[model samples]
Target: MKTIIRNVHKSFGDTKVLHDISLEIEDHEFVVLIGPSGCGKTTLLKIVAGFIPPTDGIVEMDNHVVATSSKSVPPNKRNLSMVFQNFALWPHYDVRKQLLFPLNHHRYISKEIRGSKKERIDEVLEMVGLSEYKHRYPHELSGGQKQRVALARAIAAQPGLMLMDEPLSSLDAHLKQEIRNEIKKISLNVKSSFLYVTHDQSEALSLADKIVVMNKGRIEQVGTPEEIYNFPENPFVARFVGKHNLLNGMWHDDVFVVDGVRWRKDNVSEAFKQKGMIPLRPDELKIVGRGFGNGSGAGLGDGFGGSVEGLPGVINSVYFQGNQYELNVDTKYGELKLFEPLGKWQVGDKVLVGQR
Candidate 1:
């Protein structure tokens, strides 16, 4: 199911939850909606599920208007199933009963259809690795089991599209990773498009084929995980996607100046359309020989001088971060952070700074 959201807008009184959200979800593409808590990722997901009507714009799927001025469809009629974070399930029913319960009440289900439903149930239960626990009651299952049951139920519906709202957030770290793998497996079996909502950047980066980053109820940037992480569109995106050194500088005659230091803009990527603004990644910067790169070769020009080495400043802190050591150095440009290979620097080491 390819979903097209055209100029979608939704509001409650004067508070707008989604504003002019227009997106194209390609067929069978897993798209993840990611942002901070109040960024309206979930609201947009619900509207796509047909739980709420947009105040304006059209929600269309496969060339049919699901939401428009003339008509608005309800949840069940939309043929879309969802897996929620809370694992909504019936406590009174056993696992087998729970998976088959939806089919029994389905208005279109016939006796023969009900008999054939067991094949689908068996397939999904095996997919979730819960085939042996078919008769287990909901209370007997662990958190992960309960979620598996919920996933089994959604898959049994055989929806054309699946919407998951942080389904793994409630699990422990190991369980989370396990379920993430299963999500990929089940999604492949269903061959349905997925609309996933999550605040975890790693989850979005790892799971999504396309990532939609929203901020303040508006779409900020949409791209693949690599695109968003590497080639950010603006200062906001650059800061949001990863760790960045955002320094105030003026571009004068093709050179960028931060504090008293002059750096050639060529070494760093000049991304912003507006000139005189420089944003740098930590890896792009290097600590150089004190008098090497700086134009002035005076005694002061050991090279490019900064707190990392040549310049004198106290080491604020140092911590080991797995593959690298994060160094917080108080520098002339301002407080600067440098990442070096583990065991490279002790608590207090003098170093020079420059960009290559």
Candidate 2:
């Protein structure tokens, strides 16, 4: 199904929440809406699901208007399925009953179909790798298993579009990773359009064919994972999507200067002149042993060579992050965080920071 949202706005009392939000979900594409809490991602999803009417604009499915400012098609009639953060399973019903509940309620299977309801239930259970636990109740399964049942229930409905809201937030790290992969595979096998909502950047980056980053109830940027991460449209996206060391400086004569240090600037537009924030990822900056041109002869000689120069800073703190050490250094501008792959540096150590 192709979903289109155009100029959708929502407000409650006097507070405005979504602002002229427009996006399109292509057929069988997995699109993710990502933002912080209270950013109106869920509100937008609900609008698409026909749970509420928008304050303005319209939503369409396959070029057919399903919702507008005054009217909306009921959620059940939209031929779409939803999986919520909570499993929303029936505690009294067993796994088979839960999986068959949607199919039975909607009368999706006809009498002329070759397979019975139990057979169809078993098929979805096997798809989710929960066939052995078909007879188990909700209380009998683990958290991950219960979530799998929720996903299975939604899939069994055979909706053209599926909406998921943070379906794996409750699981542990390992289980979250496992289910994320499962969701990717399931989407491929089902060949249905998926509209997912989450605040986790990693999930959006890993799962989405297209990512929509939201902030303050507005669509900040929309692009593929690589485009959004590498070329953020603005400062908020640059700061929110990944770990970055933002440096405030002035652009002058094709150079960006900060704290008496100069770096060559490239591809900056003319609109940015007096001041702007330069975002540098962790890998872009490195720590060196000696200051640039200080002549102290205290160089670390870790293959940095002479291509890169150093910026002066003192180590503020050090954190052990398994493979590498995350060091917070206090520079003239502000506190900058960088990753150190080797060597041990203590707090209050005056070190030279450089860009690779």
Name the best candidate (by lDDT): 2
Give all TM-scores, in the order shown. Answer: 0.81, 0.89
Model 1 TM-score relative to the real fold: 0.81
lDDT of 1 by residue, 1-356 (tens): 78899998888889988889999988889999988898889988888888778888999887888896456887777757789899998899888888897676643334654778888778779999999999998889999999999988876766667889999999998999899989887777676788999988778888888999898999988999988776666676666665565666677766766555666644344556364566666675555542233232113434335333233333568888899877776665565566767665655665555454
Q: How accurate is candidate 2 locally (lDDT)?
A: 0.83
lDDT of 2 by residue, 1-356 (tens): 79999999999978999999999999999999999999999999999988988999999997889999999998877868889899999999999989877877753334532257777788889999998998999989999999999999998867778999999999999999999999999999985799999999899999999999999899988999988887676777877886677787777777777665666656543333434667676767878554333232223343456543456678879999888999998876778888988677788887778776
Give each model's clash number.
Answer: 14, 0
